[model samples]
Target: MDLETLLSFEWGIMMPEFIILGVATVMTLLDLFMPKGLKRKILGWIGFAGILAAIVSLIGLLDYPVTTILFDTFRLDSFAKAFKLILLVGAALVMLLAISYEPKEGLTEYRSEFFYLFLTALLGAMIVTSSGDLITLYVGLELLSLSSYILAGLRKENRRSNEAAMKYVVNGSISTAITLFGVSYVYGLTGTTNIAAMREILLALNDSQSVYLLVISFLMIFVGLSFKIAAAPFHMWAPDVYEGAPTPVTAFLSVVSKIAGFVLLVRVMLSIFANAVTDGPNSTSILLTMEDTIAFIAGVTMVVGNVVALQQKNMKRLFAYSSIAHAGYILVAIASLSLFMFDSLWFYLIAYLFMNLGAFAIIQTLTEKSDSEDSSHFSGLYTRAPILAVAMAVMILSLAGIPGTAGFIGKLNIITGALVREQANYVLVSVMIATTVISYVFYFGIMVQMFFRKAKVKDPIKIPVGTGIVIGVCAVATVLLGIFPNIAFDFLQAQFYEFGDFLR
Candidate 1:
């Protein structure tokens, strides 16, 4: 801990996180001293600027060699860089939505706090991406979870918000406890919390009892982490939370929060279980043994999420289920365990950040206008605002995986990834296609309401400047990526190729 030793640590690897922390601190202080009557929306702009700065800083470090700080607890590698870019960009978009957010109720009083909470959550997600140890990963997860819990209940007077926060706390606590118990078992077996060191120990294991313990631990960890991604059976809390939380918070959960969850899952499963060999007559890696189990979970998640969404009349609730179904699609890539896994997952996530957030921006605008969350609120949207109606159609079509949309290309990559495997995962692939078709029923339903139904009120919906920016950017990105996916795919392949060994 001497100054010279501390100086030897490559602190430059942590520039992105440092920037976020600094920004959060400054925003908190600024909020504290600002005039009582001053508009809080300015704080959102400040937060957005900070995230832009952080994104710039991160881009500068793209060529940084694998560097671990604090005794390997935090590592800056290609994996971290790629995912952090998504986190920063997604947070930036959510910040825009926050800036323009105007609920039916007067919840603007806490708008400044909303911006800062998002920064903290982004920090946590960034940390999780780079963390090289279980303890640090868990710490980051909890940081994100706690901030999200508070954000969910920010509409303090709304009973649904209160209930959402309560459910989040209860569900999040149980998941954390289960995850910790699993980590404890892992530490007991390997005698180390360091992921790299534990990988070596687990791979060399020869005892059957130890293998059994490892399997149990794997299941516990998988089940617990499922809660974060809103994977089914564990996804019961999502619809309520999405419906209750502020619209920007809902966008954060769907895009940034879900991305972090998958990052953590990929980090842990690939690093630890990819090489952990089970001792028996037929020896194999732990991940291979559990591939079918993981596929089953993926299948169920897609089915449950899409089927349930069909029944949802609330726009937020419907998108909540949509989020769950998308998680299932990403899990398909994970279950494939192909070399192209990262490429497909990252591409899908980037596309998701654009299309999903754009859709939510429209939902927020309409819901606020009608002062209702009903599907009927969107009736005759084309008659009132044809431009926005067209934009919403693009987003909804993307989500439905139609041709010439980013979501379609993302799914194509995933399916191709699965099919190219030595032993193709036909079952999971089939389930994915079926559920995606099922999802179209709900996705197109939104379009049907917008284009076909008569408006209860004939006035045009006014879009705020911030909302317009978000919708414009997201819509452009969605179509661009769909047509020219190579822009992102090429970059991902190049970057991931260099860090490919880290997963091994």
Candidate 2:
């Protein structure tokens, strides 16, 4: 196949990315020479507007749907579009929070650069959702990871921020290296970098060693994604990084980065494992073996993430671990990859973005007026800023999977997906139920601090309009998606079927 043909786009399929790139460039130029006062806020608005344009473009392009794009290097199914919408909305909210945060974080000089990096990172995530070739997926991941490293280091003067950046880069680089090694192995085995082509090659192998090949490749790729989602054993960098990096960046990492990794995982597995049907003597079945491996990872990831999070006292670190537990829940969908799994994953991500971002944005707003990062900072939050406190409460309750909130509905779908496949996934369903209960304790623990405790120290909190508005919007979304999950799930269900057909 010609390279030009592979890279060629339908233009309509490429509009969101074009908007992201164009706005990112304009923001970069504005940062270089613009006068120093309130003008910088324009860049934040521009970034927000850019993300809105991308979201609009994504909605508009759904009318011209195709299951795959760029000669199958990309796919434009419901799964990809659903994820694109989540990422765009989450990134836009983060941009709004950052508008009020840059001055306080002492990042005033480089605030415009934040918009530039944020847009690029958003672009990378959008690319990951759409990428169909393994090579394209890898490139998109690297672009997103590199931008995140820089974002973590943006608060350069703080020792913790610098340390977090170093740890992130080192840890992230090692994971990337492992992922590439696995990709190389897959290439050598199949003589192709195309995921669809590789699945055909893998399914043809029938010996015991084929099982070993599958295990090794999945493990290597898992290393990279584990880091992205902050899963255990690979989660060492997250607590320190979350405690140190700017709060909006933490929110971005928790929501956007995790969603991107999961999107790629679903795409790759749906193509390679879900559809691998072969009849041969001594063949180790592709779909069953992959399901078992992912199920094991899902089990271990939940236990480790929640157990470790219980020990953290820092609010950011607590949420960092909370984010990991959420990652484990997302992985359960991967463990049960099927037609319904795609819908479950997208709905869950939409719910997670609201809960995670709304929670962290509140922390960012409150932290400005406090000296400590502990949960104590939230003491008497109900008494101080009742509206914001209510927003934070809604977010935390949703995250805990309490009824009448977005997180509950997301979890409900995942549990239903697991139970529907329970005959083949009994162990996974049991583990998932156990982990969900374990997670509720940690999530509600924060809510207890926010609502039940009285203030030991009295300091009035100041919240920017942008921050307040973003939190209010996320709070409303959390409630909306929770009460009416069918609306989002139905919207996503229409596009998710394309993957089922493509895989078959």
CA lDDT of each candidate? 0.91, 0.79
Expressed as tens digits, the lDDT of each residue in 254-300 for candidate 1 is 99999999999999998998888988889999888998888888999
Task: At residue 420, give the lDDT of candidate 1.
Answer: 98
* TM-score (C-alpha) between model 1 and the true structure: 0.98
Error of 1 at 480 (Å): 0.8
Kindly report which residue pairs in candidate 1 clash with one another.
Answer: none
TM-score of predicted structure 2: 0.93
- Total clashing pairs for each candidate: 0, 0
Cα lDDT for residue 291, candidate 1: 88
> For each candidate, what TM-score against the reference?
0.98, 0.93
